[model samples]
Target: MTEISDWRKRIERYRFQGSECVKCGARYYPSRIKCIKCGSEEMRDVELPRRGRVVSYTVIYNPPKKFSKYAPYAVALIELVDGTRVLGQLTDVDFDKIRVGMEVEATFRKLYEYGEDGHIVYGTKFRPVVS
Candidate 1:
């Protein structure tokens, strides 16, 4: 009954991190085995920072049938300090105050839940850095 996504382990580790393809420099959030750009099978694992800024975002009024309960949430493409842009949910603040360039930090949070498997999926999300 954890609150983090299992896939988060792919990108959220302090060590054994992800990286862009050296051959093509294609950004892989979870460190792919091959360059998604050039299809090269060589990739270098690199540590990513926990800080970034909002590159773009939107408020989801209509969610999937299963995710309808969590509708009216803000989703954003956060551009990390290393220049890698990743899409994630933005939390912990008023929706109206969210801005295009607002500073944010990585924070894992509850995304959704389902089934009788008694599992609570958690994933890495972002929240406004409180001043």
Candidate 2:
């Protein structure tokens, strides 16, 4: 991503900032300009709940070029505490131990680096919540 676009997305990437529809209370990640459910332009920024459970997941053994370094990593469809589901890479856990309904929490980590300058991109990843 270009520097300008990356800078614009820092909030959502860093803090999981989402948009909530004022009319219907629906929430969306990556923030939306228009509410899909209510079609309302009226929306407000809300920080999504960090805690969630794994709904489903798959292990990527052969990823794209950008993510090839992290191949064989688990990517999960997680349902956050507030019912906002997000897809993120699972970290600091064993692949065999992953299961549906496993609790996880958001964590900021380095995603990747790109460009001639090797700009490091950081974003949220999920880790198994320790008991």
Clashes of each: 4, 0
Mind giving the per-residue lDDT tens digits that candidate 2 earns over 1-131? 58788888988989978899999989998889999998999999999999999999999998888788778899999999989988999999999999999999999998777778878888899999999
Runs in model 1 deviating more than 4 A are 1-17, 22-26, 37-39
Q: Candidate 2 regions off by >4 Å?
A: none
Alpha-carbon lDDT, every model:
0.77, 0.91
lDDT of 2: 0.91
Model 2's number of clashes is 0
Residue pairs clashing in model 2 are none
Clashing pairs in 1: 3-122, 4-122, 5-122, 5-123
Q: What TM-score against the true fold does each predicted structure earn?
A: 0.77, 0.95
